[model samples]
Target: MEKFELDILGCGSATPTTLHNPSSQVLNIREKLFMIDCGEGTQLQFRRNKLRFGRLNHIFISHLHGDHCFGLIGLISTLGLLGRTGALVIHTVAGLENTLRPEIDFFCKDNPFEVKVEVFNPKVSEVIYEDRSVSVKTIPLLHRIPCAGFLFQEKQKEAHLLPDMIRFYNIPVRELAKIKQGADFVTEDGKIVPHGRLTIPAGPPRSYAYCSDTAYSEKIIPVIEGVDLLYHEATFADTDKARAKETGHSTARQAAQIAKMANVKKLMLGHFSARYPDNNILLEEASEVFPNTVLANEGLREKL
Candidate 1:
């Protein structure tokens, strides 16, 4: 029951409009904030949503497109201005250092915190980051540029202890940890108390996958198989398939196809084109193919 939520900051494509900003989202896992894709006006959206900036330490950028990363510098500068002292880790492609280092040096010279950029190749899928509770892996995506998606997977937890069984067996408190780790207990009378009797099965781990600015690619289905939630780009309708193909984007139908192929629990369609007055058409199209499809709107929060 720990917190696992996705907060949508911006969900529009390249052309900014009055209805939406750009691409940005915050993944809150057990109160640890991991930002994905900081597009234009991201800071304003964050403030409007009242998300705590201090809790955000790591950022994952999908690509180098302006709409995907233009707000990064501004957000970094504002964090410095707010007297943030913790280091900020940015996981992105290689060439970004050339553009961001100089800007950080000139604009944030007096800032107390440090910005650490970790580069990863977008052509191959690999584990990029890992901690005690979660592990993040890169999903190579097909885009105009070298782009990669991210998969957030939670680690398996220990088995739950059964208090009633423990009391009946008179198991000592000091032996609870061992029992949870699948160790058997021996009673004072030399009787065996199996570990299965003292603990119940652990809950299944949950996972989330984020894919944006990429064309329909089946290579990612195996990597994102059976995820709890999936966020995919739906930049056009079926009528605009030609444009979607030329721009290395996906139509609503294409996104739904990928979701169905991957067999994810729920699908979220985002990165909407500005031409559509409302996303009802896109939603309906995706829902037709994948029944659990939902539209991503700014300030929307989904819990997994």
Candidate 2:
């Protein structure tokens, strides 16, 4: 089975610190690349991590905040310079295309790549995109602006043929396709062969959920329930609750609460405040509620 992987490009909060950059992450599922957010210096972080840029085709912007999307122009320009000729898809707010078109046009007039923008206004939660291997949906988040989280789910796979059963039943090569596709087969003599007699159920699909720059909102639980991996913002500790509320961000405890409520397999906490030079406080707080919490660091890669 193909696995889902996430690369943390930048984990710091609105401000950049010496040790961390702003919010940016990359999700690689079934060999396709999807970027969550692009903050300043994100391209630098990508290079430092030695990630291959050839497969990065789609980018999801969480909001219009600078910490979340300021690096987009630079990244697109870099992609053009790197000779990426394939069309690039950007999923963002309605006005974002107009906002970036002039700048992108000016920079890419001499380039050859195509940039396609897919707008997702925050009126509701819905499936925004679907490729052959995966589907992407939006989860409404409680941020200062009209923002949404992303859910990436791999498609269910076909059942694998049991080699022993194939040989034992003397299954014909032409019938192998039918068995793998979970279809019952009929013999040349009109004898029925059940699909269960030929194949077992395929494993559960893998999924990853991302919630960034949002305040504590339990409305997202259903959208991210039972996900294999979850990345949520933890912009402050519980002690700074007032500041967190004022900024429309969540504390480490709040992020953990969301993960626990959603029953996610693993939780990754990121978008840390610059004040906390170390992430132990956030991890410690989050792990108390959700034992599987990991502090997201710049260039950290997790294969799920």
Candidate 3:
């Protein structure tokens, strides 16, 4: 199986508390790192977790909220100071470029690396980034401002070769690649062997969705349906539903409702309100609706 994991750096909402930092996470797919939402103290959290700065090349910011993007400047400056020469790509709405470019130019005047900003609309669902291993799509979210979520989906894998069949047929090593690509094999005598007979079907692709700073919106269900892992904001408990709505945040129950509606494999809730003395109440509230829900916390890592 391909290696896919998520590392939580900060999970608090609005402000950083003594117990929690704000929104930041790193998604590791096949050893490549993609950072999501650089909130305050994100670099410190990265240091605490010992994440390699050089490995991270792309950052996807959901919105312009302070809690979601306050740490970006500091992180960029630190990367330059560390002598990183690789290009850094940041994907966000176009409005941020006007606000952030001046700060970057001033602080990183003599930096060695290039900062590439790729803007995407927060009102449409579209493929923002794609490579051989995975593709990332934008999920238009219902937040106070123009906000968006992200869906990281793995590409379909090649068929698994049956070693016993290969040995029995004395198949040439050079032909294996073609077979895995679904081509039929022909013997020297012109006898044909179907590719299906020599290989097992590939495992289904895995996906992860990140939704935050948005109210409960069903429009995202089709985009995130059946994802392997879902990280949704649950900033308030069910008792605070009104507050959640008024603030463009989702309650724990609301997050769970979304997860259930999407039929996701698992739900991981975060963006907790500082008012909560403990997050267990929120977890319990979400679990009542979706039994496979878990709470997001700093340093928590989930592998799929």
Candidate 4:
């Protein structure tokens, strides 16, 4: 069976600490790497994790905050150093060109790589990017700036029949595709069969949602409903609720509440505040509200 995995690079909040870096994550789905947020030191974390920059073709920048996108310029420059000729697509909010374009041009005056940055003005939450393998959409979130979250839904794969069943039924090569597509076979003798009789149901498609540096908002529930996994920023503990609200960030309990309301299978809480000595309080508070709550640790890879 194929796998969808999330490689957590940095889980700390605005400030970088000795123990943790900033906010960067790599989603490894079906051999494709989608990067979410490229905070400072993210490239170094990528190196520590042994992830190749060539695999990162698509990038989603949640907001223009320095902690979330500061490392992007350096990463791109390194990609050029590594002789990456392939095109890189980045989906971000409008008005980023004013800040990002000049930097790219400054560093890549005569570079060979093709970098394409697409800005989406989301009026409402819906599917905005899609290919054969997966689809990505934006979710409106309440942040200090005009920021939004992202949702990634992997396309369901076709089912394959057991080898013994294929051999016993004498299924032709042409009929194999049909069976995998949930179609029953009809013999020349006019035999009738149901799709379920020949093949089992396909596994559920994997989905992930990323909410970074946003205040607790229920409006995003519809956009991330039934996601297999959710990564929500819990920049503060419940004791710092007032601070979280002032800073337009969510507490661990608030993040978990959203995860529970969205009915997500698993919840990953990260973006810890610099004041916190460790992530134990954040994890404990989130787990109180949602049992499947987990702290996003650096270099941790969770498979879905």
Tens digit per residue, CA lDDT, model 1, 1-304: 8888999999999999999889999999888999999998999999888899999999999999999999999999999999999999999988888999999999999989999999999888899999877999999999999999999999887789999999999888999988887899999999998888888978788899999989999999999999999999999999899999999999999999999999999999999999999998999999999999999999999998
lDDT of each: 0.94, 0.89, 0.93, 0.88
What is the Cα-based TM-score of model 4?
Answer: 0.95
lDDT tens digits, residues 1-304, model 2?
Answer: 5757899999988777898898898988877888999999998888898877898989999899888888899999999888889999999877787778998988777666888999996657899999877999998999899999999988888888778877876889988987888888787688887888888888888899999989999999989999999999999998999999998999999999999999999999998898987889989999999999898998789998
Off by over 4 Å in 4: none
Lowest lDDT 10-residue stretch of candidate 3: 92-101
Arranged by lDDT with the best first, the candidates are 1, 3, 2, 4
**Which of candidates 1 and 4 reaches a greater lDDT?**
1
Candidate 3 achieves a global lDDT of 0.93
Relative to the true structure, candidate 1 reaches a TM of 0.95
Candidate 1 ranges beyond 4 A from true positions: 167-170
lDDT of 4 at 226: 87
Give the alpha carbon lDDT tens digit for every residue of 27-86 in model 4. Answer: 988778899989998899999988878788998888888888998888988888888999
Estimated TM-score per prediction?
0.95, 0.94, 0.96, 0.95
True-structure RMSD, every candidate = 1.5, 1.7, 1.5, 1.5
Q: Report the error of model 4 at residue 100, Å.
A: 1.9
By the TM-score metric, which is better: model 2 or model 4?
A: 4
